[model samples]
Target: MMYQLGKRIESIVLPVEMLQQLKPSDFPNQWEYEAWQRRNLKILEAGLLLHPLLPLDKTDTAAQQLRQIIRGALEKPLETGKNNKTMQALRSIALSLACRTFDGSVSETSHWADGFPLNLRIYQMLLEACFDVNDETSVIEEVDEVLELVKKTWVVLGMNQMLHDLCFLWILFNRYVVTGQVESDLLFAANNLLMEVEKDAKAMTDPDYSKIISSTLGTILGWAEKRLLAYHNYFHSDNTETMECVVSMAVLSAKIMVEDISHEYHRTRKEIDLARERVDNYIRSSLRVAFVQASFQYFSIMSLHRMSSTR
Candidate 1:
């Protein structure tokens, strides 16, 4: 009887689309609903049991352990018919949450492979809901906490680091878009992502990864353009530090374009090139070339001064 009950818990699957509409009040006030909540809570608890800081010496085993824990939660009786669609959704969410929470590897199992994109979309929707419903202060704190977990996970996964980082940055980017406040860490993550991608160029070839990367690059460039316009307005208001940071980011954006898209070696070079050109044209139309040149020169001089002062 206990075994059968556990299986029923695992079989509970919520559609990815429904996650956005989910609310604390949405929990049905009944014994079964309460049981379902408790089960999910336990799964989340077990998911976070292992330390994320541990060396990747046994990551494969860690992945297996996570999979087993999820499987254990999912154990069901033979009499309970399969809900294939719901199971797929649950498995996708489970694997994504497990990977995000535990720093475990993303399972390449058929279920995970088929539904990774949908899983990502669901996570983003949940995040958006979190921001929209909660007070900004609490939401920022919560989002930051969640993002820290993601950053830790990024340390463990080798093959999926780019995808994870892009997701992380996109969350921050979306946050900034919705709320005008910028997080410096988003820019920092962007820089690190560009460095990682440059070091391993093959990530550009994965269709899913490439699709997200292309869209994210445009979003980032758009943000930078907005910042540049702000700098242009305040150029005489003693915002040198802000101007310098914005210019440095723009330079990094250009470097990403030149290195990733412009390289003839990239498999999706043509599509990426067009994307880059679109962003460049957008930037050019919004800001002056001479202003950009001046900001770069100013940034360079500031760097030199800091170097001299340290010596």
Candidate 2:
């Protein structure tokens, strides 16, 4: 397949020529082939149309034209044969978008797959490869080897160590969540990694990196806050082991967002106590909720007793 195409060849992907020659029989079944074909097209849609590396011009018909072509393909899959007119047009516009840059210069470097969330999503998928295939909840022993392969993709994805740390943080957090949140070690690992991200957040200045880190940290913080904001509601004696890591992460992510990403917090942040404030809020809110629930249950029981006496 494309001569084992050397990795990170200036963002080059499966060429239009190779795509044109593909057929359904080449795969194990029609469904698999169609899925593969649809996926390739969607990748093009994501990279070129949805999230190209550069700011897309609204006046550029190439984007609109590509959108229409993809939409039509969705309704009716297009032929990929060499002589197909649709394939030729798809190749042209897709390349045009992939090759365009901010400075209006012609360059061989394609930015197709190097966009913001798209690159992050691709990196996350690659990160998932670290998990054991047989035991989806567990990590493979060869994670270092898999990570080495992942780091090589950084060249293609326009990623650096900082972004890698952030993605790895969320990946671990998510795996912990999806695996029933019993694995406190994953939470611990994510919190430790987040310490590195906090340092990176302080020093890194790239806008793209900022945008991604903000969203990624926001997501991690959002999930953390839900549990921490009412720890009594969620955590119990049976599952209190993960609470420390959760609270630490929640507070750290909040501090990072406030100190690094938020303009409003610049002057007042140093005076504000993130940990103490968060813990106080959680305790007060949870106690108020519990008190209200208890009152409601007591009143309901009294009303039921009165109804029994009247009967």
Candidate 3:
């Protein structure tokens, strides 16, 4: 029955129309939502088997260990703000915890050589791609080639650590760049920075150290943004609004980092800005009319509330 239900769910990718109407708060209890999540996870697991391009492992002990680590890490960041720093910390913690839990002896044996360099390289490549939109065609093709090489290299090296590192990197990049946050360069840098910061924090031994780690990293990222802006004229084209939008988004990302470290305010405003840009681009391209219509309806409702309040 579980397998059948999972298969059914896997056959359907829920439309944006359906997702827009969902409200988790409407659920009666935590158990109800958990059951939904478990079903969804099963569906995803099953779908993985059908994909020719993706690698799958049925007895993936590392994957099982990752689940336990993620549960613990998710709890830590609830009180911390939902900013970039906290998100990255949670990711790093989960990766470390997963390694420790999966193969306890191996985790101790390969502590320093696992996650850092791979995370750094991934971040660097992503950030570089954010700005390169020109006659430089086949960029994505090149990236895919490099990724294949890296995958092959990992197999040759016989290290499961690369798998965990890449999984976290993929999740973080997808969440911020491919889905939520839209400023490609900033999203790229932010994802990388989070991993880098987490690496540094792990070395600290002071009590109440997480706060110190978060604040210090937040400040450094903010400083780096300013440096990038100071040299922006050298890198950006004058007439390119898309590039301008990317730069603006990067600056806004720093504000999110600050909010996460200090808990000063929510950074939803920037997210809304990026969403607006994406929506406008979609409308211009006529690519997903249903999504555009739903967005318009949402905006109309909000605008009506504003006008009615003024009256």
Measured by lDDT, the strongest candidate is 2
Model 3 Cα lDDT, one tens digit per residue, 1-311: 32543533212222111222333555698667445544443332232222211233557564455445345543431222334554345334433432342323423221211233333333344434523356221134475465454553342123333233434343334444344344454345445655544444334443333443444344444443443434333234653553454344344444334443344555576555643554355334443444566799999999999999999
C-alpha lDDT of all candidate models, in order: 0.48, 0.82, 0.40
Q: For candidate 1, lDDT tens digit of each residue in 16-92?
A: 22232233456666455445544553433333333221222455554555456445544641111145544354455
Comparing 1 with 3 on lDDT, the higher-scoring candidate is 1
Best by TM-score: 2
RMSD of 2: 3.5
C-alpha RMSD (angstroms) for model 1? 16.1
lDDT of 2: 0.82
What's the CA error at residue 89 for candidate 3, in Å? 37
Summed backbone clashes in each candidate are 2, 0, 0
**TM-score for each candidate, following the candidate numbering:** 0.44, 0.81, 0.25
